[model samples]
Target: MRAHADAFIAYATDPDPRVRRASIEGLGLFLEDAERAVGLLQERLVHESGVAERVLVVQTMADLVLRLPAAAAPARAWFDALADSGSTDADTRLAALAHRARCAPDSIDDRTVPVVIELLRRVTPAPPPEQDPAPDDRRPSRCVHVRPRRRAIRLFPGTSPQHSTTSNATAGSMPPTPLLKALHEALGARFDDRKALLTEQLRSADRATRYDAIDMARRLIASWRGDHTDLAVHSPM
Candidate 1:
């Protein structure tokens, strides 16, 4: 597999949905083999029409960019391309925006935050209208693929009860859950200086501020656990 980049490349053109999906799956496996996975994903972002495939590509490429910064350069164009594509579906665009929010938080400043925030708000759990029919008390359906806890272990470890609880709630919801997305924004804002910001927030002047930050931190940790647990339960072995 180490020397089989071409083998993985074959799936890039496969027509069958399952075959295409497997080919997309192979890209991740071949990340080590395919030095050009980043480039390949960038190209796919423009031409690929499948929502699930686009989401997977965006998510995988986002992780790859973060892990291999040198490989991340080409992804910036993908982000811009996705953002500019009026033809792309809302969910796919939103997923791309979410990745952009992670990959280039600063790039989404005054001009874009409002749009992203609006999208987030629209997708957020809505309080029922007064005249609406009573709904089930059960938790809502969540995004299907949340990566896993292994991916989030370093960024969000369940160090407190609050963290554990939040993690569960995040995992129980469908993909693009606002809480998970909010945490991503919050953490992205801090970037490499996260630890310092966490420490500062934990020691903030206002008691309310400290509590709020702590609460958010807990939720983040819990979300990571939820993602990990969900993957373990549903993943094909």
Candidate 2:
């Protein structure tokens, strides 16, 4: 196991995507030593730039938690830090959100809520570029309409989170647009105050802020039962 783990760590940043992917898959063999495996994946995440490779590592951590819930604290802590770090990339942050939703929803706290909201507001796809009409020659040129395809929803399915190099891991479906579904799951029912805070952010002039506000408001409304009586009433409120 040590030899295999060492080899996986060495190849994790291989120039060839295939080699890197193979190394990511091979890391699954070390789940018996989940703390060590989690550490290795965390290291890879810090340096790995390819979206597919990062997704594989994040999903593998989720698998480890699923298989050995008792051993998940290290992995959960890693994700919590990643999700909260402002310097983290959007892809990594999104993966951390999804992993928390899947493996450690109860661990998501007030600190993570604001970070999730900020990330939701910032990650938007740019508009497609307009094309020039073909020059000269002919009858009126017809406009061709191309509809964007809906992304397929794929969940991490393996019990052990380990799969072959060709595993169909995708970053696209990692909490798609809106982001509230994953956030709702991660925040659970103990975040009424945070939900109210996001409600205020809904009134922002910024388009992304308003968009995230609506999604978060919808999530809170859909699940809200009553006020959190355990929370102290502040004088400002």
TM-score of 2: 0.53
Question: What digit string (tens of lDDT, one per residue) describes model 2 on residues 133-221?
Answer: 65765468589888845333333323222311111123342323323444555556556645544553553333333443454565565
What lDDT does candidate 1 reach at residue 11? 77
Q: 158, model 1: CA deviation in Å? A: 21
Query: Please, what is the TM-score per model?
Result: 0.50, 0.53
lDDT of 1 by residue, 102-205 (tens): 76666655445445444434333343455754577456777598864522211121123433222111222223432234335645544323333334434433
User: Could you tell me the TM-score of candidate 1?
Assistant: 0.50
* Clash pairs, model 1 backbone: 141-174, 142-173, 142-174, 142-175, 143-174, 143-175, 149-228, 163-218, 167-222, 167-223
Number of the top candidate by lDDT?
Answer: 2
Error of 2 at 5 (Å): 6.2
lDDT, candidate 2, equals 0.58
As a whole number from 0 to 100, the lDDT of residue 142 in candidate 1 is 75
